[model samples]
Target chain A: MTGLSFRYGERVALDEVSLSAEAGRFTALLGPNGAGKSTLFSLLTRLLISRQGQIRIAGHDLERQPRAALAALGVVFQDATLDLDLTVAQNLRYFSRLHGLPPRQAEQRAEEELTRLGLWERRNEKVRALNGGHRRRVEIARALLHRPAVLILDEPTVGLDPPTRRLLVDHIHQLCATTGMAVLWATHLIDEVDPISDRVVILHRGRIRAAGDVPVVLAAAHSDSLADAFRHFTPESPPAQEAC
Target chain B: MPWLLALRGIVGREILRFLHQRERFLGALVRPLIWLLVFAAGFRAALGVAIVPPYQTYIPYEVYIVPGLLGMIQLFNGMQSSLSMVYDREMGSMRLLLTSPLPRWWLLVCKLVAGVAVSLLQCWAFLLIATLFGIELPGPGWLTVLPALILNGIMLGALGLVLSSTIRQLENFAGVMNFVVFPLFFCSPALYPLYKMRESSETLYWICEINPFGHGVELIRHALYGQVSWPDLGMVTAVALVLLALAVRGYDPRRGLMKRKGG
Candidate 1:
């Protein structure tokens, strides 16, 4: 993304935002509530286009070649996008069809992902019957079904228990390490960012306050901990009347 | 081929949802049946029917209102699907659908086609009930009316799409009923002939004459008798195309309703 900006009418939700994540790396986008993390995800997913800037996913321009750009992306939105009425396998099949995968390939991929996620035993169960952790796993599996070049997750572990959250975080990190997939994980949870995370981009009020390797950001903020670095970059309150 | 597969998936989802919601099917049939069975019986004597343009001979009130009731089924089903669209938007499934790599217009068309398919099923169910009640159309009319039904279904579904794009909340659906469904049903010649409406008020007659729903009913009525009405067909086709274009524009991410966060 290059100078990506977005606004809802007069309220600027993202101001000249720009960031990048390389292959085989896990990048944490840390931000507070209403820090334009979701907005950035929306732009990346092409749900809301940014008029002022450009986004290229896997070398495909989002605006000029949206279909290619979108095809290269795998997204797990903040909200649960699964159909509660459909079985886990059924949900995956439906999404694969949307991605234009053939029946045999779709089924094979669904099985592969479900097995990898260790949810193969529960594939026939309805999504509504699954617990939060399992459901999140199913979503992650669905996102991977198309074998997208980049995986974008917006707060994938928002409401899970601590153990489940840790498990999911580790799973994503493993995916990055093994598949060499560029992963952009957005969250406000500092602990979710592992000490070995390749990079951290801290956004506050629609602007990138600090972005770099964890130790570099820590050094730049003159702090020992990632949480303290986040606090130092993002003040408790904004200066009055400045644009977001 | 990919387009065809996506279409099948989307349409299949709609069908599955329709099947699951038995109450929705029953509600759609029950509303039209009430109008056909009880309401028509009550109003039959009060409102006399002369030789309407679509009807060569004098027809019973129930027979006259059947096409209008068919329009009603499509109208309500169209709105119901749009209601689901709003729900999907709020639930984030719509976001998932929009993010698909397919062209936005094609995706919306898939949604419209799914809605029309459900509406067609409801129309046939209503016709079957009407046939049971001794309001059978000409034998060949069954085959002939397919095109008309499909056209009307698209028209009403497109209108629903337009409304869905503008409506921000699911709670505001009641407002749509009052402003859109009711007016479109009542203002058109769906329940009465234009001449009959003119007997009450000239302004209302003109309103009915111009209503695309009115032309839709006229087109279906003609097709029911294995006949054709070029003017009505043309009007319905034109209206449907225009409304569909508007609906496509309404769903555009940069400019349409999805641009707003809460909306």
Candidate 2:
């Protein structure tokens, strides 16, 4: 995405924001509450159109070729989007059909994804019967069923336990590494960003405060820990040298 | 072909959800049943009817109100479908749907089609109950009314889509009931003939005459007797098309109500 900007009436949600994620890399979008991370995700997913910028997903411009762009993109929103009454496999199959996959292919993909996520045994259980962690896993599995070129997750670990959060973070990172899929993981939790993250984009007040490789962002902020670097870039912090 | 597949998936999901919520099915039936059984029995004596174009002879009050009650089922079901749309938005499922690679118009049309499909089921169920109560249509009337019911279902469902797009929060749905559903149902020829409304008040008679729901009921009522009303069908078709376009525009994220709420 380049020069993307959006406003909700008078309030600017994202202002001239431009960022990119590379395939086979995990890019962390770190921001505090109300910092426009969700807005950016909304734009990337084409849920909200950006009037001021261009977004290209897998070489398909969002505005010019939305179908192709959206076809290549996968998203797991902050809230659980699964039909609670439907079973795990049923939810995945529904998603597969939404992507226009044939019945045989959809069934196979659902099996493969559910098995990969370790939810295969409970595939027949309704989603309402599953725990929160399992539900989130189902959503992640559903998102990956289409084998999208880019995966966008918005604050995916909001209510999970520490162990589950760690597990999910690791699983997505593994997906990035093994499948060569670009990932934009949005979270306010500083711990989710570690030394392994290929790139970090810190957003504050609808603009990019710092964006670069982990080491470069850390060095630019002159902070040893990511937590401190994040604090330094936020609006609440006192004036510091510009990191961008 | 892909669009067809997605349409089938969406429509199938709606049917599954409808089946799961047995209470909704029951409620959709009960509302109109009461109007047909108890209310129509009382109104039968109080209200007298003359030979209308759709009816060659004076019909019983219950007979006149069956088409109206049919419209009521679609009306309530349509609003209920929109209520679910608002709930889906709150629960984030609507976001998943809107982000599909298909054209946005096609997606909304799929939703409309699904809503119409469910409404048709409810309509048939009610008709069966009405049949059990000794109210039967003319031979072949049952088959002929299918197209009219489908058309009316699309019209009402499209109106629901328009409402769902404008209503930002779930809490505001009751407001839709008061402002949209009640007015659209009460003011139309669904409950009474337009000439009867004219006898009471000219303003209301014109209002009912112009109401698309009134035209829908007229179309269904005529078709229920194995007759046709080209003007009523044309009116309903035009209104459905116009409202459907408005619904599509209302959901457009860039310029529609979704943008206003920053969804």
Best by DockQ: 2
Give the per-residue lDDT digits (tens) of candidate 1, residues B163-261. Answer: 889988889889998888888899887888787788889998888889898899889988988889999999999999999999999988777466666
**Per-residue lDDT over B1-263 for candidate 2, one digit per residue giving the tens place of the 0 to 100 score:** 78988999899999989998999989999999999999989988888888887898888888899999989999898899999998998888998898889999999999999999998888889988898999867868778998999999999999999888888899888899888888889998787788889999999888888889989999999999988899999999999999999999888877734453332
What is the lDDT of every predicted structure here?
Answer: 0.88, 0.88
* Residue pairs of candidate 1 with colliding backbone atoms: none
Interface root mean square deviation for model 2, in Å? 1.9
Question: Which candidate should be chosen as best, given TM-score against the real structure?
Answer: 2
Every model's TM-score on chain B: 0.96, 0.96
Q: Which portions of model 1 miss their true places by more than 4 Å?
A: A237-244
Query: TM-score of each candidate?
Result: 0.96, 0.96
| lDDT for residue B141 in candidate 1, whole number 0-100 | 78
Alpha carbon lDDT of residue A197, candidate 1? 61
Candidate 2 stretches with Cα past 4 Å from truth are A235-244, B260-263
In TM-score terms, candidate 2 sits at: 0.96
